[model samples]
Target chain A: DVKVTQSSRYLVKRTGEKVFLECVQDMDHENMFWYRQDPGLGLRLIYFSYDVKMKEKGDIPEGYSVSREKKERFSLILESASTNQTSMYLCASSPSDSSYEQYFGPGTRLTVT
Target chain B: AQSVTQLDSQVPVFEEAPVELRCNYSSSVSVYLFWYVQYPNQGLQLLLKYLSGSTLVKGINGFEAEFNKSQTSFHLRKPSVHISDTAEYFCAVTEGNSGYSTLTFGKGTMLLVSP
Candidate 1:
């Protein structure tokens, strides 16, 4: 069974604070993604990494950045947290050869106050 | 670019009743379709996926979906649902040729099963 683990299950940060959400996959998948899910807005992609040190912006990448220094770990960075950034963040990983299905980690619910 | 639309925002059903959640997608090239379930405060879990070969795909938890290319729809259905089946279901699509494999998800349909 594939296991994707997130660093934090829940987090609360003040406005203008820096936040980091980490994700690690034991499957050694080459593709990792970060998404923020909102009610009625759906799961919008924030950023994705295809390989180490390679990143691409998704539909909504503003105020967010990602790091993939290693194949097993992917991190999501909030430049400066705001109230609007408060939401559930999900991390997913898929194999490079077969990207059809992705395994997701338990999400992190971030609250910015 | 690929996009997915889940027409129904909410579907309420009784225990042991049948239920259907509609999903439509738009993409010029070949696409892969998937349905995911998210419990309260949990991450999304892959329910089913339609890659190739078969149009009717069955997934875990007795959930199934039919891929209709002509209609551009992949609707999920279950014959008998349980109270534990209550969750948010999302439909997603990815372009076959894009190589990125990033998914575009629908707004999601909330399934409320009551006794």
Candidate 2:
């Protein structure tokens, strides 16, 4: 079974603070993605890495960046936390091939105050 | 570019009642369709996927979806829903190219099962 794990289940940060949310996958998949899920807006992608040290911006990448130092670990960085940035953060991974079914982590709910 | 639309935002039904969540999409190329379930605070889980062969696809948890190429729709259905089946359902699509496999998701539909 494929397993994706996030660093924290819940996190609270003050405004203007830098925050990092970590994600790790045990399946050795090649594609990793970060998304923020909101109530009505659904899930919007923040960033994704197809390979180590490579990153691509998604639909909503503003004020956020990602790091993929290793294949199994992908990290999401919030340069400066804001109240509007609070949402459920999800991490997912898929195989390098055409199989696009993403395996997701439990998710990290971030709160900015 | 590919886009998905889930028509209903919420669907409330009694236990043992049949239910359907509608999804439509527009894409330039042939597409792959998928339905995912998110329980409360959890992330998305694949319910089913339509790749090529079958128009009717069965998934986990007794859920199924039908792919209609001409209509550009993939609707999910379950015969009898339980309280445990309550969750948010999201429909997603991606270009079916062997090389490209990024997904575009729709605003999800919440299914509330009442006892």
TM-scores for candidates 1 onward, in order: 0.98, 0.98
Q: Once superposed on the true structure, which residue ranges of model 2 sit more than 4 Å away at CA?
A: B98-100
Best candidate (score: DockQ): 1
DockQ per candidate, 2 decimals: 0.69, 0.67
Please give the RMSD of candidate 2 to the true structure: 0.9
lDDT of 2 at B107: 94
- What is the TM-score (0 to 1) of chain A in model 2? 0.98
Taking all chains together, the TM-score of candidate 1 against the true structure is 0.98
Please list all clashing residue pairs in model 1, or write none if there are none.
none
Find the 10 residues in a row with the least total lDDT in model 2 chain A.
A93-102
Runs in model 1 lying further than 4 Å from the true structure:
none
Q: Point out the worst 10-residue segment of candidate 1 chain A by lDDT.
A: A94-103
Against the true structure, candidate 2 reaches a TM-score of 0.98
